[model samples]
Target: MGNCCRSPAAVAREDVKSSFSGHDNGKRDSSVAAKKAPVTVLAGVPKENIEEKYLLDRELGRGEFGVTYLCIDRGSKELLACKSISKRKLRSAIDVEDVRREVAIMRHLPMNNSIVSLREACEDDNAVHLVMELCEGGELFDRIVARGHYTERAAAAVTRTIVEVVQLCHKHGVIHRDLKPENFLFANKKENSSLKAIDFGLSIFFKPVQMRSNVVVLWPDVAAPL
Candidate 1:
């Protein structure tokens, strides 16, 4: 099997094409390697020890900024999601303004049902890690694609929460320029399934009289004029 556990090579050669090829092999090796590989220790963070803070056992997802790991706090065994932004991107962006904005927003955003709870934010010399509650129910987009379409009642139920969240964001002078299914996550896996809005990468803040530019260009028709 290809190396499933993270290695210097996997981290260095992170790309979609190469990733799929290695995935199967990695999956085969997951169980054994998981027992052998020590969980990554988050730096400059509080709590008795970082290990007790989070136990990164699996790779949940990944993005341009970083990867999300399914972690469990040792003491409570409570599941959590930890996103680690790459060191390369930290220094890669010429402006580095977006990173600053994201961290600031996470720190300032109010805790409510409308958004994902930010448990902690930590940074070491190489990366910034944002720790949040784990949502096992999966992404809204995945559900939509799997089910094809929602019933009218289901659609309304989901849309109502989404609209409320968006309205709250706007009220706080923040604009979720990108509103899509993937960004919505299911909080409770069972009966009372709830949506927890995730990611603010494309979000921008604006005052009452201010207008923010849309960072996401869905298509040419809606693309901002250059």
Candidate 2:
């Protein structure tokens, strides 16, 4: 129990030799410093906010609660993805709490390696902007459809990475209930790149004493709820 919270930009410092090595490198503080708790205010987008920091390019996708866009940092010119969720979309106080919990989990997750990293978090009068690493390599679904089939070794290697991700999430009490093939992505446009788990909107936290849920979840290769 090192630190459970931090600013969206600040993260723990754990030097590791490699990722996907399947080695127990031990754990360290990796939580965002919990703040005074400011829920994303329900309103419309203000004139100025993340727009000043990022140059929005195109719409990646949209959902009932939010819209994700491809963007570039104005200062660094770095390509990134920004998820903008409208506060007005939340139906009740519980919905707000859900968003807050999702953010907390995303921030606390060790995302520097096996997962897509959340680069920054900001909010305007209308929505909260979650800046994350852009995965231009496309979805695992696309790759699977393109390849058609894989050798036993290739399949096992991919399976091992998936297991590592689930184990990592469960170890930290977070459950990615809505896991799916479309939810995972590669960091770059390389055939040998590692996989990254993404989209934690339906994820939840559980206590060690809690019993597992029997409900079936439609993920890629494994069950979602344990």
TM-score of each: 0.72, 0.73
Clashes by residue pair, model 1: 4-26
- Each prediction's Cα RMSD? 9.4, 17.2
**Model 1: runs farther than 4 Å from truth?**
1-52, 92-95, 212-226
lDDT of 1 by residue, 1-226 (tens): 2223352123544642354466485454444443332222333353233333566666878877778877677778788888866554544343256665676676667887868988877654345667898888888888887888889999999989999998888777787666778778998666368788988766777888676454444535434576
In model 2, how many backbone clashes occur? Answer: 5
* Clash statistics: count for each candidate: 1, 5
Alpha carbon lDDT of each predicted model:
0.68, 0.72
Residues 25-95 of candidate 2: C-alpha lDDT, one tens digit per residue:
54322453332234454334343467778877777767668777887889999989888777656668888
| Candidate 2 wrong stretches, greater than 4 Å | 1-48, 214-226
Model number with the top lDDT: 2
